[model samples]
Target chain A: MTAAAPPLLTVEHLTMRFGGLVAINDLSFTARQRQITAIIGPNGAGKTTVFNCLTGFYKPSVGRLTLTPPNNGGCFLLERMEGFRIAKDAGVARTFQNIRLFAGMSVLENLVVAQHNRLMRASAYSVAGLLGLNRYTRAERQAVELARYWLDRIELTGQADWAAGNLPYGSQRRLEIARAMCTEPCLLCLDEPAAGLNPRESAQLNELLLDIRGQHGIGLLLIEHDMSVVMQISDHVVVLDHGAPIAEGTPDMVSNDPAVIRAYLGAAEGEALPPDVAGGLPTAPPC
Target chain B: MLKDALAAAVVAALLALPLLGFRLADSQQGLSLDYRFAWVGYAAAAVFIGRLGMAFAAAAFSRVFQRKRQTLLPLAGRPSRNRKIVGWLLVAAALLLPLAPFADRNLIDKATLLLIYVMLGWGLNIVVGLAGLLDLGYVAFYAVGAYSYALLSQTFGLSFWLCLPFAGALAACFGILLGFPVLRLRGDYLAIVTLGFGEIVRVVLLNWESLTNGPNGISGIQRPSFFGLPFLAAAPGRTTFHEFFGLPFSPGQRIIFLYYVILVLALATNLFTLRIRRLPIGRAWEALREDETACRSLGINPTRTKLSAFALGAMFAGFAGSFFATRQGFISPESFTFIESAIILAIVVLGGMGSQIGIVLAAILLVGLPEWFRDLQQYRMLAFGGAMVLIMLWRPRGLLASREPTIRLAADALEAAPQTAGEAAR
Candidate 1:
């Protein structure tokens, strides 16, 4: 990636206020195309709020959220669109912090549902599909292929016929990512993809995220609490404290910054920093 | 178990205190209280024994059923091949019902009523089951369909065939109309709005005397004819169905014809629903049911998908309503009351939500069983209510709990590709 190439998404002065509280205030960042930009913060630092605004879940009080699609198709003003339009029209897909697979639906059906808009067009408003037309059958075959491909990628092929809720926790998390990928999103926003996972599962998640970025060339905006995953995999890191960015740079630069440590420790501004605490900031944050 | 029996005896004694101790009788002169000590004691004993028996049976049943599986397991794996066989058997039985040698007018009539409920259950299933929209006012569409047919036929002298589609269209229009305001609602709020909508339609029909004939309702609505021939006595100028068919005109013939008409209509509804369930929109419905936020994230427009469910469900209800009006030769607001909506909703829930075949079995059990026990008179509803409670207790997920996936990676897809001629030679 070159500096001259434009970023895929740009959030300029994004501010979201809920009543008297400012959840995300004056945030600006750029997620380069095919790059993993990690948003790491202490609890209640409004990391998820930034993802919400970019994905059109919440309208920012004052900001411009722009998404530049591949091939320069058009720049989508994400905040101006509805949540679903941001997904359907702007080609943005997301997974929730708490896993939100269609619990009663099968794993295969979950992936197929992610391709709903495309399959719907092939079905010609379902008339063709209902009539068992060739176009629908072809599209359907392709959909099943896509579902199977992802199933194998997630290593859940054996559980394809099982209800999504019946899968193990780690597999459900992978299934959610696979489901998001099936939407063919230009930008994937994941909220805490590594939550509630063992060390090995986190390592697998890192590999999966790296593979997604490598193969799909889709930009990823991640909100993660795990410092190891963020420090290991992130190309760019943005640190937020009290709804505003406190630090931004490569993971190495941001992790070593004193302000990032102080924010994480919840210390008051200008408070005397402990010598050992300041000195002990690891150059390489341990996983 | 003995403790439970003792508790039940105390509760029974409390219950028997008022009704068993004294009964209000309308004597020739005035109302009087009559003592029935022995009868009260007997009733109390019966209640005590019944409660004890039920508790013991339930304990024994759970002990047997739960011994192998202590944890609640997901019941929705791939439906077994056996289920497919059972489904085919059910369809065959329904098809052969009218042709059975022992079929009588009353039995056929009951079957027709049962099929009507089955149709209504399937219609409600789309909204409440597939789309996960709790539409309590489903009967409003039924009312709209019935009135559309009744008014069209009476005013314009339109035949049943013409009115049928008109009725369905009008009902669909109402469905969309009702769907708009509740687009953002879900669960209980949606249920409330739908219930209100159902009541509003009934009240409008009742108050609008000129249009719906008010409480008197529209009557003498013509029965559906076989093409241009009426199902009546052959006369000098009229061409009757029996006369055209060269058969004796028994009254039972008309009942049997009506039964087949409803059978065809109900079967059509079933087929359309089953087919639609496999389509993209159908999948969208189930997705929306599971999680609306996820549906939006997947690029599915919830409004359009939900509206389609509402309109489609209402359209079938409208068709059934029109059939109801024609079959009974009457249309009234009373017929489309909240109880009717409840019964239809009950059928859908008791049938296991989106299960098509489950709806049929539920309708037979709920509608047909009650009618068969009509000899119970005042206790019929009591028995019906008790049966419902028992069923819900035994199977909270309804009788048929399996869910068949809409799509599969067929085993054949994994097999080797066809060998080319050169490859085969090699």
Candidate 2:
């Protein structure tokens, strides 16, 4: 990605502490527009912590998170905003490592709820919707159309009326992405989007992420365990170990970095490992 | 299995022995131990038989449906065409009951009481059912409404209609006040705080004698009228509802009038709930209910959605409360105690949390049956508890626990709701 492409989200000197433990320390990264920036990390690497701070689920001990959407919405200093405002005004949308679809609602309703802010405005904060007025109806139809488009894109149109929880695990993953996209966010943060998928579903997820990055003019910040997804589709990759960036470059460069390998495989076993090695290292790639 | 059942019986007998085997009998001289060991044997025998049967049933059920249950969970809450017919039939019966041959003043009065509960259940459903906020202080809003109407009507000499909006507004303000502190809580913690809030409201009313009249609640409150005509006998100079309609003066006119008033209020509540479910706010309630974190992540404000639900639900409760005060021609803190909150909560749960039609059936079962069984007297509570236990065992959800989605998109989608299990357990 070119430096002149313009950054969508700029994180500066981000630090998060829970009591005495520093979960993330001095973490900083900039994700550019129309790019898939993957944060690949071992377990306990605080990838989700960074996403949490960016999404306003947590206020970092010290940090600045600036998200500038291409639509000329003012720069959102996310760390200072309320949890909902980060999404509402800053246009930052995310899906969870554990899928967080509105499980009781229908698939279509889930998508429609993603467009809640827009429809909420059109419905005049619900007075018009209560009266079933024309403007609200037109806006609601348009919201459904957006939901329908995403459903078709995600190939979930048939299950549009199914309760979201009842969907197959793979479909739930895809549907979660669709729901996030329905928000029309400038920056989408996905926490382990391919966590529980089968190989085929993982490939499909990679393709979907690629499609979103290539066509939607939206920035994608993904925390992925699937090497195929990260190495295949990501425009840039940031490798994290011990809650700090160990390597940063294109996916090929990060994959080839010795520090990244050491973080994952743990110093080739019995090579006099350091005293503070964060936590256990996985013996193999999760994928 | 027989040996396990025998062990359970032995434990059960040992537990019951102290309570049932020896009771302190009142004698002329003093208290003496009286052996009632037969009751202990009966208790042991019941447990033994129940344990054995349940064990056998569990084994059979597992053997039969172990694989099928997984596939069937999603199919449970679909509303079939016949069920819709049943719902409408129930409504029709409710609407036509006053004209029935057996209808009496007492029966209509009881029906009106049942309708109040139905309205309360619907109102509470928006908060507890749709938004998934378990409000144990809902009766506080109801009390607020009643007190608002009573105090305003008496002090200001305002008509019931004039005070109605004030009552609702006051209750809504109280709801928002309660909501602000409790929005950060969830599930059990939220319920705990709300439970305290209800008691606080009741205690305030009990002590604030100056404004509320304390234990001696404000009386001679104004009654609601039909449009501009009052529901009273036509005096020498004034025209009452019966007089205006040219019908003969009958005391039953007031009862029927009160019944219709509550019925309309309850129907309007149900309609509002129905319409809102299809709107953005209603959908937001459901979404927030599903997961607050997800809601915030998606740009829907959890605080606003939850507050709106609480306020709207409280507003309806206020309306019901105003009607309730006018209906009884009296008001007091005693009427809005913790037990009333429990009963309302029970109706919502017993009707299946988000199910609209289920509230009607629940109201009939929980409120109607008790009023009809007033002759049962001391045994009323026993029968009520027994019926609730039986229903929980049978349905474990509610009588008509069907949740059809407010809107649908897929062609020929299954009519049943997929949210068949969990959530309500909260």
Candidate 3:
């Protein structure tokens, strides 16, 4: 336990069951501010199920998922909250593995909508906004200013008015992240954000994620299938196979762990790790 | 071409043989079979000719418009630049319609009826179009509004103006009532529940005779006045609208006044919807429509957002219903049926989900033209359904279904973007 850093989110004894199957079992991890924690695994490893439980999308059969924002902001038991309350009150936001932008709305509008809770207050639940009050205008301008800042971060300012769905796939992925950040979350969870990206796009995603952690000073929880991304940027790593953790440590430690290597390679016990496997488990994506 | 046409003719002849070729005729002794093979031959020839014509038309159309289609198809999802002019033209037409030489009281009255539907379509546009909730029982709120106004006005001798807001509020309350049970439902399930809700309201109105006067419906509903001045002729020292204006009182005055009133109300509905789309709640509704899951993750409370949409949408329906009651001076369960809901929804869908301008055109096409063909009686519905089918084939997204951004940043803001020059390198 490092007393130097304060934990932002802590998941303990997390277990999820779907009828006869346990999708996740006994998952424990702590994510601190300004850190990126990545969960990597083989297929059906309950990586996304962890995300579901933390974001309140699914109720874990047994677990305690807690989020505590910095500076005594609030302590929220996420598993007890509704999905929106987790985002609105607990300040935890997520992007889907399959990109889910408001495809028909403009990119800027997509970001603006993520700030709905803040503006809803300024608008007094829409009555003041409907009446064209000056307060609402000021609030809306600030929302736009924040949205413009994210657009610049992702280099999407030029295409802010383009319909979100009309953007290229890489742009859509970045836009989804920007939209998630627009909610000003204490912890941002990204689910396979680089799933289909080419090597260059993946590199750009690494840059953006690093910038977000360093500049915004927020904790990030990542579920990544791409070994290159998990290895290069993640501060700490957790590996799971068949709903149970096999290894957990720094990326370097996890990559060299015999159990993680065996889980990735499905090899016989004591088998030698490949030259590349020692750097990134399974050496996937050729990056 | 000839070979394909021959095949079509053969298929048509086989299908028509049983229906057209032979008939059972009652003869003196017993039922006898009578053959009319010539009728089958006629059917085959008709099919043959139709197939040939269609083939020729297809060839000609493709040859003439293939290049145009390529240029146009990519831009189909965007709102056209000239839509502003088209919108202005529509506005002008609506304003000038009652005063046109050809627009007598009969014509103006029909136009007024059409505007009522136009208003209803706009109201449903919020729920079904922007919010993406498939409401099939929207008319229940319409019925609620109508009944609320009828009962209040009769029981307490309330004026139409005094009861309008109450009718809208009452209907909105009912909307929230329906909204709560179905917040978790979507697509077909939501639709089924709403459809059932519509029927339930109609049935309640039908059987609750003591309160609703049963199937006989409430009658002698008060007509709306211009503020406090009724449209009726002057009595004693009190003056009607025309009498106050020192103009001749034609019976047409009342019709024209009603037309303007609905026109103003419809415009108010349009203006409010247009303004709200730029607000947080409206944007939230659109976002909710686009992706409900994404909405949840973005801190939008799905239930509250959906309920607000339902209540606001029903409020508009209630307003339209009150106007409907006043215009007809009668109300009943028969007025608010599943078909009425279907027609209002059709106007929203056919107008291209969220397009305000499209709703106006759809209302005119779906409601106005059908009235013009009222002479067809039962066949009018057949024509309406056929026209809708043809329209779906032509523009599956609804005519003018431009999925345009509800709001665009000003040009100067685009200019202020620092990456505009850097984008080329990217």
Cα lDDT tens digits, model 1, A1-287, are: 45455699998999999999999889999988988999978778898888888777788899998899987678999999988989998899999998999998888899999999999999999999888999999998899899988887887765676678877788899999999999999999999999988999999999999999999999999998776688788899998998999999987788678898878666333333333434576552322
Scored against the native two-chain complex, candidate 3 gets a DockQ of 0.54
Candidate DockQ scores, in order:
0.47, 0.47, 0.54
Runs in model 3 with CA error above 4 Å?
A1-3, A267-287, B1-81, B234-237, B376-379, B413-426
Candidate 1, residues B163-229, lDDT tens digits: the string is 9899999899999999999999989999999999999999999999978889999999988888888
Q: What overall lDDT, based on C-alpha atoms, would model 1 receive against the true structure?
A: 0.86
Candidate 3 structure quality by residue, lDDT tens digits, B195-276: 9999999999999999999999999999887777777776666778888888877888889989998998898888888888
* CAPRI-style class, candidate 1: acceptable
Compared with the true structure, what per-residue lDDT tens digits does model 3 show for residues A60-175? Answer: 99989888899676798999999999999989999999999999888889999999999999999989998999999999999998998898889887787777876778889999
